[model samples]
Target: MSTHFEERSGVILCRTSWGSWYQTMEEVFIEVNVPHGTSGKEVRCNLGSKHIELHVKGQEIFKGKLFGTTVSDEGTWTLEDKCLIRIVLMKTNREAGNCWASLLEGQYCADAWVQDQMQRKLTLERFHRENPGFDFSGAEISGNFAGGGPDFSNLQK
Candidate 1:
């Protein structure tokens, strides 16, 4: 059967200006694909120099070096029921390009990382191919509500 996941290298929806790629707020996003049953404590993302290491139980699950700007300190993640980790990486003016253009450039990831992802996609495709009567589950990749953003405005007396 067809699963809910998409075979994506990386999908970066930049909130840029219409005229030019101007991000009013210095921010970007990172979407991580987590397995069906993953706990919040089990997942860890160490961000440094546009590189990220996803670890579960102190073991690296996914390792890839992003080609975009450095991941800002300000960001949030939502882990949905299906176990998709959506991380919104806050960006800064210091970094260069946004996420969308960056990930497309090179294969800056490990073979295991690439193989694991490809296998997942292939498995789904195979299931559909084999089962003629199979239908999609329509399972959406969602996340839990962590917290709100920082208050930029001044407090009233």
Candidate 2:
């Protein structure tokens, strides 16, 4: 069965957990969420190097490979609330222009960022394992960050 998901308004009302991406200079953030009334216990999200799978209510809503220039499986996932999750896909190239054009046909090690991200993920995992019960909370959960130069069009250049 195929996962059916789409974005409408600021909500992620889904019959299946599909996804949508909005990109920046350095990352692609894919939004996934379960339909209203679906409890957190009823949802599962598997984030991989080249694909992501989201399941809810014991049925898979999303299971698809990702694509793009220099896409790293080394992304981050966070529960926006009790009903939503955000996946952060890092960009390998700073000047690749827009990468949201393609996101379903690529290899994990196809880019240098893959290596870097692998290391990063491993480090984070190790840290968490070593510091069991340590809370890294209160950090910037928002994935939006620097992607390129800031435009000061209203001011004098």
Candidate 3:
């Protein structure tokens, strides 16, 4: 249902799901855990071309315009580790019927990267493993895109 990213004294949790209707977007929620007694009182993020909204202590912090897929933004902040923590909600378009369908569907290659406090950078190379008969239509229709479905006995190998 979700994936967890953890490290010493901190954790980054991420959960994603498909959304309703013609939109059929993938929604992602993230929570970052900081260490105790640290408080600069700010938060920063870099969400590339996905809608995002922030909240702290059960209160709305920032509300930004909803840009379908063209605009992207980033921010940084300092805060207490024991604080309520920060959450980022993001949504991206589905691959079906879209221009990038084949590529987004894992038929191609993707590149990714990450950085740590030591300024060390990690690069990743990825490719999609083919699932011949997998039906993505259900995810395109219903908001529940978590991935359990009927067997693909009908799909040709």
Candidate 4:
């Protein structure tokens, strides 16, 4: 959570000395930078249900537990541009609003945008509680309401 992350198109991204990683609600994508002429044969990547180990040219790039469980058998990796190792990991949990706080456990945290989104949801829920008959679950509050809060005029009840 070193304030070195950004959110783009709903994907949270973080960069490290080795490379970068981004995640959607359903999957985590990692890109590791290797030597310019590195080949797939020089890469060693192991995907476990709760851990991952990646090595390039016999050098350990990363090896640690993941932030969340993933379907290891469905995970895949490939060497692109002869210098980049791209990996795709499918999450075991795909419930709505489910998102990883980071790629690795206790590592980089979610971007501020994600935190803001969560805050907005909490604010909406508070408004809903104060104004019954109005359903705010999953509601996206954008712009300003007439009373400077959630518009309850269109209450369900």
Give the candidate number with the greatest lDDT.
Answer: 4
Q: What lDDT would each prediction earn against the true structure? A: 0.42, 0.47, 0.28, 0.68
Clashes of 1: 5
Tens-place lDDT per residue, model 1, 63-103, is 67654555546656666775666655555532111213333
lDDT of 2 by residue, 41-131 (tens): 7767776666777777899765677665445456776766666667777766633223333445532222344333322332332333334
lDDT of 4 by residue, 27-126 (tens): 6789888999998888889999999999898998988999889999999999999988999998897532345666788765557675445335434544
Candidate 4 has which clashing residue pairs, if any?
A: none
Candidate 3 local lDDT, residue 111 = 24
Better of 1 and 3 by lDDT: 1
lDDT of 3 by residue, 48-146 (tens): 553344444444444454434422433223343465344333334422221121112232212221112101100000001124234222222222222
Sort the predicted structures by lDDT, highest score first: 4, 2, 1, 3
Better of 1 and 2 by lDDT: 2
Q: Superposing every Cα of model 2 onto the true structure, what RMSD results?
A: 14.6
- Estimated TM-score for each candidate: 0.41, 0.46, 0.26, 0.65
Candidate 1 achieves a global lDDT of: 0.42
Off by over 4 Å in 1: 1-26, 57-61, 94-100, 108-157
Off by over 4 Å in 2: 1-19, 37-40, 69-73, 106-157
Among these predictions, the greatest TM-score belongs to 4
